[model samples]
Target: MRFCVSLFWLLSISSLYGQTAREIVQAADSKMRGNTSQAQITIQTIRATWSREMTVKTWMKGTDLALILLQSPAKDKGIVYLKRKKEVWNWMPSLEKIIKLPPSMMSQSWMGTDFTNDDLVKESSVVNDYDHSIVGDTIIDDRNCYIIQMLPKPEAAVVWGKLLVCIDKKDFLELHTRFYDEDGSLVNTMNASDIKTMDGRLIPTRFEMIPAGKPNQKTVMVYKAVMFNRPLDDAFFTTEKMKILND
Candidate 1:
C-alpha cells in the first residue's frame, strides 16, 4: 500500500511540473513581445566572403500585427513588410508594387538573411502551438536555465518538428533555442545574449541565428532601442500604410 501511494504522488508531481514548464514558456514569450511595441533594429548577415547590414524601424501589436520599414542601405531603403493577421505583404519602393506573400513562401529567407518570413511575422505562437515539457536544467551564459522541450501539436500549421529552448529561471528569459526539422534533424540554433535593461525591461539585446553545420555563416539582430505597450493605431498595419510610410 505504501509503494502504490508513493507512485501516485510521484505521478502527480510530474504532472504539476509539466504545467509549470508551460507557464514558464508563456511568461518568456510575453516578455519578448508586449501588447504593443516599437523599436529600431539592425540585422547583420555574416558570411565567409562578405557581410551586410540593414537598419530598420519596427512596430508590433500583439501577435497579429507588425510592420518593418527599411531605413538604411540606399539601394534597399523604403522597403516595407507588413503583417496583418495571417497574411504578410511586401512593399517594394523601386518596383512600386505591393506583393502578398503566399503560404508556400513563408519558409523563404527574409531579406536574404537566415531569418525566415515566419520568424519575422511569427505566424505561430510557441505557447499555443506546442506542448511544453521540462527536460532538465543547465547554465547558459552564466545564467541558470530550465531546459524546456516544445513538441509541435498534430494540427499545428508550423514547420518546426521540435524546439529545445533554454529559459533563465530567475527572469523567465529565453537564453537559447534549437530548432529541428520534420525529420527530427537539427536545422538551426538561436542564442540570446548581452542582456541589459531596454525600455524599462531587462532582456537580451542581441540574438544570433546560426544554421547547423555552417560555422562561418550566421545572422545577428541587435536591438537599438525599444518601447513597449505604446499607443499604435490599427491602421498603421495595413498595406496602404506600408507604402505611405517612407520614414
Candidate 2:
C-alpha cells in the first residue's frame, strides 16, 4: 500500500512540474515582443560573389503593427515599410511612390535579403496559428533547450508546413528555428546568438538566416539598440507616417 501511494505521489509531482507546449511557446513569444518596441538594426546579406549591408530603424506595436525605415546606404535611405494588421506597404523615396504589397508577395525576399516579407512584418502568430508540441530536449551553445514542433492550423494562412523551434530553457529565448515547406523539405533555418542585455532584458542580439541547399548564402541581422514597452501611437504605423519619416 505504501509503495503504491509513493508512486502516485511521484506521478502527481511530475504532472505538476510539466507545462503544456502552447504555454511554453507563448512564454517565449511574449519575451520577444512587448507592448511596443523600437530598435536600430543592421542587415548584412552575404553571398559567394558579393555582400552588402543596410542599417534600419524599426518600430513595432504588438504583433500587428510595425514600421521599418532605412537609415543608411544613400541609395536605400529614406525608404520605409509599414505593416498594419493584414496590410503591408512600401514607400520608396527615390520613386516618390507607395507600393502596396499583395498577399502573394509575402513569401518574397525583403530587400533582397534571406528574410521574407512575412518575416519582417510578422503576419502570422506562432502561438495562435499553430499547434505546438514539445518533441524533445537538446543543448545549444551549452544552454539547455526545448525542441518544439509547430504545425499550422488548417485555417491559418501561413506558408511553412512545419516549424521546429529551439527555445533556451533558462531564459525562454528562441535559439533556433527550422522552417519546412509543404512537402516536408527544409526551406530555411534561423539561428539566434550573441545574447546580451537590451532594454533591461536578456535576449539574443544577432540573428542569421540561411537558406536550404545554399551553404554560401545567408543574411544576418544585428540589433544595435532596443527599447521595449516604449510609448508609440497607432498613427505612427500608418502609410502617411511612412512618407514623412526623416530618420
Candidate 3:
C-alpha cells in the first residue's frame, strides 16, 4: 500500500511540473508564428444593412507589429493601416492624406464594418499585451483544443477584461474566443468557421463576432481571397503603394 501511495504522488507532481513556463511560452510561439502575405477581408454586420469587402496585401514579423495595404471597391483604394508598438496610422486616397488614429478610436467602428477598427485588424496579442494560462482541455468545432485565458497586463490599453481563446489542437489556429468585461462578464464572442485552403494553408476562412447582450448585433468576415506565407516587400508597405493600389 505504501508503494501505491508513492506512485500516485509521483504522477501528480509530474503533471503539474510538465506544464512549465517554457512550455507555456512554446505554446504561445506556436499560436502566432507564421507569415500571411495577402488576404481578402470582408466585414459584414448583422445589426445593420451594410457590408464591405476588400483585398489586403500584408506582412508581419510578430505580434503588435506589421502593416497592411487595402485595395478594391474603388473609393477605398489606396488605404493603408500601419501599426508599430502603440502607434497606429492610416493613409487615405480620397483626400490623399495620412491620418493618425487616436488610441481611443481603436475601439470605434472600422470604416462602417460591423466590428470595431480593432476587430477588422487582428494584431497578435498573447505575448506583449496579455498574461496567458492553459485553463484546461476542451473541444471546439469537433477538434480538441487548449483553453487559454489571456488578461491584458495593463488594464488601460484595451477595452476587454479577460479574453478566452480556444486553440485547435492540430494547429494553433484559433477556433473561438470570448472577450470579457472587467467584472468578468462576457462582452463579446467570436467564432471561426468555413475553413478553407488559403495560400496553401488550411485556415478558418470565415470569422464571426457577436456582441453579448445584443443578439441582433453581430459581425461576419468572409475571405474572398488569401495568399498565405507569400513574400511581400517592405517598400510596398508605403503611402505611395497605398495610393497606387487604390488608383
Candidate 4:
C-alpha cells in the first residue's frame, strides 16, 4: 500500500513540472505576432516511382492565410491558391478560372504527397477548429516535447477528426505529427528534418509525409529560398500579376 501511494505522489509531482502536451500542439497553429511576409518557395515531391518539383512565390499575413502562386517545371506556372478567412480558392492557369475547393477535395491527393490539398495549404487555425488537450510529455529528437492530441470541435468545419502533434519545448517548431480519420484510423504521418537557413530563420529544411496503408510510399519536400519579413507590394497579389506568370 505504501509503494502504490508513493508512485501516485511521484506522478502528481511530475505533472506539476511538465507542460501540457496540448500547448505544444497549439504552437503549430498559433499565429505569428507580426504582419505579412513574402517567401520564395522551392517544393519537391516524390511518391513511389514518381517525382516532380515546383516553385512558388508566397505571401502570408499569418500561418493560416496566404496567397501562393506556382512557378516552375514548365507546366504548372501561374496556378494560384488563395486562402482568405474561411474560404479557399484555386486558380488554374489552363482553365483561367477560379474554383472554390470543396471540403471533400481537401482529403484528396495533393500533388504526390499523402497529404490532401488541405494539408498542403494549411490556412486554417487549429485553435478555431479543434480543442487541444495535453495527453502527456515526451522526448522527440532529443528535445523535451509535449504530445498533444487534438480533437475537432463538433461545430468545427474541418475534416480531420484527430491529430497527435509533437512540438519542441524551446522553439515551438513542429517536429512531428500524425493524422487520423473520423473513424480513428491512422491516415498519415508527417515529419520535418534537415534544418536550414532561409531569410535568417532556422525552419525545417525538409518535410516528409507517408501514408499509413501504403508500403514503400512517401512524399518528401525540400524548402529553399525561405525569405522572412520581406516587403512586397500590394500589386503582387493582384490577378494582373498572377496573369503575367500564367502567360
Candidate 3 residue runs with Cα over 4 Å from true position = 1-33, 48-61, 69-75
Arrange candidates by lDDT, descending: 1, 2, 4, 3
Best by TM-score: 1
Error of 2 at 134 (Å): 0.6
Measured by TM-score, how close is model 2 to the native structure?
Answer: 0.91
**Model 1: residues >4 Å from true position, as ranges?**
1-4
TM-score of each: 0.95, 0.91, 0.77, 0.81
Worst 10-residue lDDT window for candidate 1 reads 116-125
Candidate 4 Cα errors over 4 Å, as ranges: 1-23, 30-34, 231-241, 245-247
What value of lDDT does candidate 2 attain over all alpha carbons? Answer: 0.90
What total of clashing residue pairs does each candidate reach? 0, 0, 3, 1
RMSD of each: 1.4, 3.6, 4.4, 4.4
**lDDT per model vs. reference:** 0.91, 0.90, 0.66, 0.70
Per residue, candidate 2 scores C-alpha lDDT tens digits across 1-247 of 9999999998876554344777888888878788899999999999999999999999999988999999888899999999998888999998999999998898889999999998888888888889887788999999999999999999998878999999998899999999999889999999999999998999899999999999799999999999999899998788889888973
